[model samples]
Target: MNTLYFAYPGELETPTGGYGYDRKIIAGLEDLGWQVELVPLGAGFPFPAAETLSQAQTVLEGLPAGAQLVVDGLAFGVMPEAASLACGRLDLVALVHHPLCRETGLSEDEASGLFESERNALGHARHVIVTSHATATQVADLFGVAEERITIVLPGTEKQDFAARGSSGKLKLLSVGTVVRRKGYDLLFAALDGLRECDWHLDIVGGLDADPGCHAALLQQLSGLGLTDRVTFKGAVAPQDLSGFYRQADVFVLASRYEGYGMAYTEALAHGLPVIGSGGGAVADTLPDGAAIYCGTEDTGKLRSALKLLMTNESKRLDMSAAARRAAEALPDWRDAAAQFAVALGGVRR
Candidate 1:
C-alpha cells in the first residue's frame, strides 16, 4: 500500500481554510486507499517559540528514511533548518497555501525574515503544492522556484441549494472570515459607515476569539458608528449551521487584504449570494467577473459605492446572484481536487 506522512500545525479540525483543505484532502487520500499518517506538530506556528521549534525538530527528525512527507507551509515556512535536515532523510514536499511573508500587517524586517526562511525551506523540497495559480506564480517569481516544481490544486466547493433570501425590507449582508488583520474587518466597517442611510443589516460570521484585541477594536468601531443595532457578530458557526446563514442572507462580502485561496468567496457563490470583495491574491482567480464587485484592499470609497449599488438595485443583485450560481457550477469538486493532489504526490514519488 502507498504510505504518506502529513505534517501540520495545530489540530486538524481547526475552522480555518488551510485546516479545512488539509482535512478534506486527508479524507480524500484515505478514500483513494493510501495509508496516510497524521503528524500534529507544535501549536505555536508561523511565529513559533524556541521550545516549539525544538519540539518540531525532534518530531521531524524521527521520521523513517525514504518516507514520503508532506508539510503544511504554516509550520514548514519557519523551519528551514528542520526542513533541510528532514529532506536528507525523507522525500519531502511542501503544501503552501500562500507565501507566509505575504500575510498582512507584518513589518518589513519580519516579512523579509519569513521570506528568506520560506525560500530556503522550499528549495529543499522535491515538489511544492499550492492552492491557486496566483500562488504558483508568486512562489516562482518571489521564491525562485521553477513553475514545473509547483502544482496548483484549487479548493473544492460543495454543490448546495441556492440561497432563499428573506423577504425582509432590509438588505442582509453576510461576511465570513476570522477577525484578523488580514481579513480586513476594519476596512469593511469603514466602508459600511457611510451606507447607514440605506436600509441594511450585516452579519459578521467568524471567530472573534482568534484575535480578541481586533474583536474589541471592531466592537468599539461599531459603537462609535452607532451601528451596533444593525450589525451582528455571529462568531464562528458550525458547518451545518453555515448553510442556514447563507440561506437567510441576500448578499455576501469580505474585504480581505489577501487570500491564498478565497474559499469563503467560493462558498458564497455556491450559495448564490452576490459577492463584494478585494481583487487581491487568488480572489480574482476564484471569483469570475460579473459575479462579484471587486475593490482594492484599502478602497473604502469604492466598496461603499458597490454596496450602495447592490443595496438599492434589486435587478442588479439578482443578476449577480445568478452569475454567482453559474460560476459555482463551473468550479471543481473535492474529488477532482483530490485526484489532482494524488497526481502531484505520484510525481514526487517518481
Candidate 2:
C-alpha cells in the first residue's frame, strides 16, 4: 500500500475551512486504502519562530526516504529551506488552500516576503494541489509555477436537505467563518449597521479566539452602532448545531477579503441559503449566477442595498433561494473530490 505523510500547522480539528479541507481529504484518502499519516506542527506557522522551524525540519527529516509527503501551504510557504532538504528524497506535493501572501492585514513588506518565500518553496514540489482554479491560476501567475504542474481539487459540500427558511418576518442573515480580519466580519457588521431599518438579524458563527483583537474591535463597532441587540456572536458551533444555523437562516453573507476556497459559502448553498459576499478570490467561481449578490470588499453601500433588497423583497429572495438549491445539487460530493485527488497523486508517481 502507498503511504502518504501530511504535515500541517495547529490541530487538525481547527474549525477553519483550510483545516476542514485537510481533514476531509485525509479521511477520503484513507478510505481509498492509502496508509496516511497526519503530522501536526506547532502553531504560529507561515510566520513560525526559530524553534518551530527547527521542529518542522526534524519532522521532515524523520520521514522515510522516498516517502510521499504533502505539506499544507500555511506551513510550507515559509519553510523553503526545510522543504528543499526533503525534496531530494521525498516526492513533495504542496497542497495550497490559497497563497499565504493574500491573507488580510499584512504589510506590503510582509506580503512580499511571504510571496517570495512561497514561490521558492513551491519550486521544490513535484506537484501542487490547489483547492480552487482561481488559486491554481494565482500560483502559476504570481509564483511562476507552470499551469500543467498544478491540480485543482475543489472543496466538496455534503448533501443536505434544503434550509427551511425562517418565517419570523425579520431577515435572518448568517455569516460563518473565523472572526479574523481576513473573514471580513468587521465589514459585514458595518454593512448590516447601515441597514438597521431593514428588519434583519445577523448570527455570526465562528471562533473568536483565532484573533481576539479583531473580535474585540468588531464587538466595539457593534456597540458603537447600537447593533448589540440585533447581532449575536455564536462562536464556533458543533457540527450538528451548524446545520441548524444554516437551516434557520434566510440568507448567508460573508464579506471575506480573500478566500482560496470559501467552504462556508458552499455549505450555505448546500442548505439552499442565498449568499451575499464580495467578488474576491475564488468566490466568483464557487457561487453561481442568481444564487449570490456580489460586491467589492469595501463597498458597504452595495452590500447594504443587497441586504435591504433581500430583506424586503420576498419574491426576489425566493428566486435566489431556488437558484441556490440548483447550485447545491450540482456540487460534487466528497467521494468525487477524493477520486480526483487520487488521480492528481497518481500523476506525481509518473
Clash counts for all predictions: 0, 0
Model 2 alpha-carbon miss at residue 67, Å: 0.6
For model 2, the stretches where C-alpha displacement exceeds 4 angstroms are 163-166
Q: Write the per-residue lDDT of candidate 1 for residues 72-96, one digit (tens) a residue.
A: 9999899899988988879899999
lDDT of 2 by residue, 1-350 (tens): 87889999987888778888988889999999998998887898878899988998898999989888899999999999988898999989999999999999999999999999999999999999999989999999999999889999998899997654635787888999999898887777888887867788899999889889999998899999999999999998666678888888998999888888899999998888889988478987887899988877667888888888888888788888888989999998898888899889888973
The TM-score obtained by model 2 is: 0.97
- Candidate 1 stretches with Cα past 4 Å from truth are 164-166
Model 1 clash pairs are none
Highest lDDT scorer:
1
Model 1 earns a TM-score of 0.97
Per-residue error at 219 for model 1, in Å? 1.3
